[model samples]
Target: MLGRPVSLIEADDASNVDTAIKAATKLVKDDRVDFLMGTFNGDVAIAVSEFAKQENRLFMVTGAHIMDLTGSRCNSHTFVFMPNARMMAQAVVPHIVKAYGNKWFMITADTVDGKAALQAMTEALKAQGGDVVGSVTTAFGATDFTAPLMEAKNAKPGAVILNLYGWDLVHALKAYTKLELAKEKIGVGGMIGGEQIGRPLGYANNAGVWGLIWDPKINTEGSKRFIQGVIDKYNHTPTSRCYHGYAAMMQVLEAVRRAGTTDTAAVIKALEGHEFDGLKEGRSYFRAWDHQHVQDVLVGEAYGKELGLGHYKILATVPGDAVAGGVEQNQCRL
Candidate 1:
């Protein structure tokens, strides 16, 4: 992107805050990397973002969806490329509320990301004159969700909102299906859900309306190219996680190309308010104020079987502007 060969170095933080800081330190001090990117855990990402700020390096947060990463805890050195909890909630909550009704039961992973999801969903629900009737918090890596699922079922809310992700989400869905919550007219959905969560749970078990980052069914030219590249290189379909990594890295490189230097301040300037094709149907840009990547968010309904490249059927394509709240709503001063 800079018209020069660029070297890449990687480290795994194991989703732990301390481990992530250590790994980031090595990348900045030992490897002398010009940029830092990638994190999957909210707390870990926050810790590393502070570390990056201290070191005066730019960090592109790719996966973690905690709102504070771009909200109250936002810093000039860190830019979030993934949709945060508020963005997802704004896009999906209405569909879920309309499909299932006003009352909700929540099953949230007890962590920063999960908390953000819970809060965002709650706010969105209330905005629509709805409320959470009952909720439960689970450990980050809990494997069994029988108790919580039963509680949610017994609450008999119009829908159950899962403020969980990854395997926690998968396990919850397993129990949700095993207990036949849908059969009882209790719908289920969440702020974020996509092929990544659905594939492991299997098509038959993946049920819900969800906020999706991306899906292969997106008909944009950029989307097609991205999907083909992933299929060719990895021999598998790409998920939203893949989209986050690819798009974030691409934007970072593009910023360097635009700035004509890897200098931190210059690149940061290049990225601020910069617009680009996000491989989606709507506008994409890093908001100049908060550095949140504002882009399209999709609402999808999971099917009992695969629909070609995905297990979810696209229900609506919400433009980024409609969901990404205005400056007053974004609590970041940076």
Candidate 2:
């Protein structure tokens, strides 16, 4: 896209903030990379973003969902490609309230990302006239959810929100299934889930109405093409995480092409307020003020068995504009 050969250098951040900053420094000073992308942890992403700003490099966050990245900590050098906790909560909370109930309980991982999800979901639920009856925080990677799940069940909430991701989410779902919480008429869900979590948890244990970043069932031509491309190369269906990496990189490269140079300032200007094919059914764009990627957020219900290409049956495709708060609401000065 820059009209010259580009070299990609990747370094594992080890999900640690210091490691991420050190790796980013090497990529900038040693590898001399012009742009940085990809970090899943909110803390790591934020750290790398600060580094990017100091070093004058563009960093595209692919997986982190913390709102601060595009809110209080927002900077011109950093762009978030994944939906934030607020967006996902606003998109799914209404559906969850309607399908499950107004009273909810939460088992949240005690990290910035998890706390963001807890707050977003709580606010979104309260906005819908719902309330969080109870909540408990667990360590970020806690394996045993017995205490929190039991406490949640004792509260007898109409639904439970698992504000977690990765294996933490997987293990929580397993414990929920083991407890047979659904049989008691208690619904469960969270801010995000898809093939990445479901594949590991398996269909039998994957239950609830959850937010999905992307699913194979989306019928858009771009979605079809992206899915096919992944299948061709990886021989496996692409997950939401896969889509985040691909889409974020595509946008960055496209911005570089439009700017006709890899100059950081020009690329940032090219990306701000830019609209593109999100590979989903919605108008996707980076809000000029916050640089958050606004797109469709899918609400899906997990079944005991697979339906089509995934475990979740899509329930709603909420438009980005319908849920993404206005610039004033986002509190982003830039």
Best by lDDT: 1
lDDT by residue for model 2 over 21-120, one digit each (tens)?
A: 9899999999989999999999999999989999999999998999999999998889999989998999999889998889999998888889999999
For candidate 1, lDDT tens digit of each residue in 162-231?
9999999999999999999889999999999999898887678999899999999999999999999999
What lDDT does candidate 2 reach at residue 86? 92
Supply every candidate's count of residue pairs whose N, Cα or C atoms clash at under 3 angstroms. 0, 0
After superposition of all CA atoms, the RMSD between model 1 and the true structure is: 1.1
- Model 2, global lDDT: 0.91
Looking at candidate 1, the ten consecutive residues that score lowest on lDDT are: 1-10
Quantify all predictions' global Cα lDDT against the true fold. 0.92, 0.91
Over 4 Å off in model 1, which ranges? 1-3
Off by over 4 Å in 2: none
TM-score of 1: 0.98
TM-scores, all candidates, are 0.98, 0.98
